[model samples]
Target: MTKLLLINAGSSSLKWQLVNMPAEHVIAAGQVERLNLPGTIVKVEVGHQKTKEVVETLDEIAAIDRVLKRLITVGGVQTLDEVEAVGHRVVAGGTLFKGPIKLTPSRIDQLRGLSELAPLHNPLEVKCIELLAQRLSGVPQYAVFDSAYFQGLPEKTAIYGIPYDWTKKYQIRRYGEHGISHQYLANRAAEMLKRPLSELNLITMHLGSGASITAVKNGQPFDTSMGLTPVTGVMMGTRSGDVDPTIVPYLMKRLGMETPEVVIQELNASSGLLGVSGVSSDMRDLHDAAKSNQRAKLAMDMFVNQVVKLVGGYYTEIGGADALVFAGGIGEKDPVIRQSIIDGLGVLGIKINQKLNEADHTGFLEAQDSRAKVMLIPTNEELAMARDVQRLMDAEK
Candidate 1:
């Protein structure tokens, strides 16, 4: 049983898990929140026991050091050497990386080159990899890409209606993100239904601060909502998803912005729920404000409407769906959002058991007479990363 450390370094947070492979038993799991900010908190859980600490500093290197030390304190490991390998969840692999690969200096440089493709995620992921490499010394590290799963998207689905020459020269095509979560949901859905993944047609929704929906046809990624980058998917916490392309240029001129990056930054950071409602980016906040604020109510409505529209299109694109799987922060926990989206999808005869939908668990939520199954599957991207690492390790052996 190899011990593997799975790392998912986000823009401002770090989530990690230490697990025994083959058995897949989690030794410990934790995260560092408010990174690089005041009141940085580190939380760790071993079994049912949880611990939290307020640390003074948490730059990348310091964060890595703290996690290792906490692991020993929490009895997750006697020494750092107990960890046989490390796996990182890299957001964008582009077309260059189709699967998990051992991280070498050259490979790290290659990944860094794709930073522009995932500016918010890749650079940070690479930094974490480099930091871990120094701290762990000879321990093997692997990168499991989130975009790898969508590499198989059909050409027609991936290509934009742009000039072929430009598309070819710029690699401007749909390369969906959150693929790690989406792929995990699809596999879990297959296990729950007791069916071969190859035989299932699924629509997986990953709705969180960053949201995306994917269509799985016969076990493969058929299509997805995120395009070229994560910013193009359904409405997210702060991202303005699926806006008119002209809006960028129009905003630049209208707002007297010097560059397109300024407008893009607003789209990625100031729009969505926050932009529409002028409230907090969090869904819970929107729910509260929606009670009295029309803009907040509209924001919530727009989110549900966008999700339903994408699900409907994917359903038709896949001929029909066997199950609509929900996974991610809002998708797995928010019954109200789930019900609203499902209610909007009523035209397709999809219905969920209200009692089951409101339950605090993961499983089938579809009503008995519903045409297709509606499932709530909690995504385990870390486990998926660990599995990929194990697969690569076994292959090397």
Candidate 2:
């Protein structure tokens, strides 16, 4: 079995997993939180034991060095050389990459060019790749793109009602994000139902801080909620999911903002749950405030409504769904959110067992007579990345 290190770097944090491939067993998994800031915390989990430490780091390179040292101290590996290869989760591959590929100097340069498409995610991912390549030396590195899964979206579904010449010139089309998680959910749903993936139709919800819903037809991505960027999906922690296009120019004129970027910054950084409730972006916080705050309650209601609307549309687009699969942070843990969204779909005859829904489990939670199965599958994007890494590595042989 080969050992692979999977790296998923976000704007402010770095999540890594060391795994034994082929067997698909995790050796260790953890994250470095609050990078390049004070109170940087390194958290590691090996089997059932977990450890946390504070390291003084001013950048991702320093943060990565600390992670490698901790791996040895925790006995995750005897030496860094044990890690045969590395795989990175790149948020936006654009049209340049249709699938995962080995990371080379040229490929890295191409990824940097796409940074404009995923300003919040791809730049940091590229930085991590460069750091790992230098630190790990000759070890092979691969990039697993989140957008690659939806690269096959139908033209009608992907294109905006804009000028055709503009789309061809600017590449302005729906390129869904969180595709890694959504793809994993679809594969897992197939396993749970014991159905061939090619025969299944699913609506997979990836509701994290950045949320999105994907319509899977015959085991492939048919349509998704996220547009050209991740900020266009269903309501997220801070992003204003879907707003009128004219709002950008209107906000700029009214606020005396010179650039559209200024208005977009607010939509991306200050909107959504935090903007609506004027409270924390977290769902748990929203739940607590909803007991007494009307705005908080409104935010929660709006979130559920948006999710249900998208799911309903996708359900119809796919003709019907065999299963409504839930994954990601909010999808897997928050039973209340799950119930609220599923309840909104009652018109479609989707129902879940209250007892099973409230329980802490990962499987079918659908009621006996519900028209479609409701699955609660925790996403495993790292494992998915490792599998891709293994595939590409073996291909080179």
Candidate 3:
């Protein structure tokens, strides 16, 4: 079995997993979050072992150094060669990227070119790849981008009617994100439902700090709400989703803002649940405080409303869905919120068995009597990445 390492490398932090393939078993997983801060935290959880390391000044280089050290010294990955390959969760594939590409010098340049599409992410991921390749020169790496799977999306569904010249020149269009999670969950939901992937119409909601919704028909993405950026879909942790175009110039003129760049930054970084509640980005915190905090209650209401609207739209877009799958931190775990979302979908003939739904401990989180199922199938992006890596490795062999 070839062991694979998967990385979700960001500009400031890195989330990684090492899995034993063929078995698709996780050997270790960890995250280095809150980059370049005095209270920077590196967390590694393996089986029953969990450790958190806090540092004062955690830059990217230093963060990677600490992660590599832990992988070798603590996590039992003794050598670089012990791992057969690496897979990255690249955020933007644009139209230029269609499928997984072997990480190469030329591909690095291509990824750099795609940086204009994801100014915050692709560049950082490319940096991580460069550093890793330099340090482990002989090892192979591959990019399993969030936008690549959406390539199967219909041209009519993908293209926005705009000036042909503007789109041609700027490559501007909806390049969806969270595709890896959606693809993984869609297949998982099919399996859980004992239905073929092609036979099911599914709506998958990835509702973590950063959220996205997708409409999957016949196993492929039919439509997704997320646009050229992750900041365009349902309300997210700090991102304001689906703002009017006029808001940009309005802020620019009203606030005496010089450039749209900073305003864009504000939209992506300073809005959403955190902005609404003046509370934490976490839904759990908001939910807990909802009893007493008006802001928290309002935040949850807005978040749930956005999700309800998205689910409703997707149901209409896909004609009707057989299953509505929830993944990500919030979607998989938040029962109260899940109930609220599903309760609103009563018109679709979906019902949650209070007993079975609450007792959903296994892969299925559905009410036994419900016609249309609502599931809490945990998203396994690493397993999907490893499967892709396994296929690629076999192809090479």
Q: Report clashes for each candidate as comma-separated counts.
A: 0, 0, 1
lDDT of 2 by residue, 275-323 (tens): 9999857777789999999999999899999999999999999999999
Model 1 score (lDDT): 0.89
Better of 2 and 3 by lDDT: 2
Task: Using lDDT, rank the candidates from best to worst.
Answer: 1, 2, 3
Candidate 1: give the clashing pairs. none
Question: Positional deviation of 144 in candidate 3, in angstroms?
Answer: 1.0
Across 343-387, the per-residue lDDT of candidate 3 in tens digits comes to: 887777777766655655546556666666777787878778778
Between candidates 1 and 3, which one is better according to TM-score? 1
lDDT of each: 0.89, 0.88, 0.80
lDDT of 2: 0.88
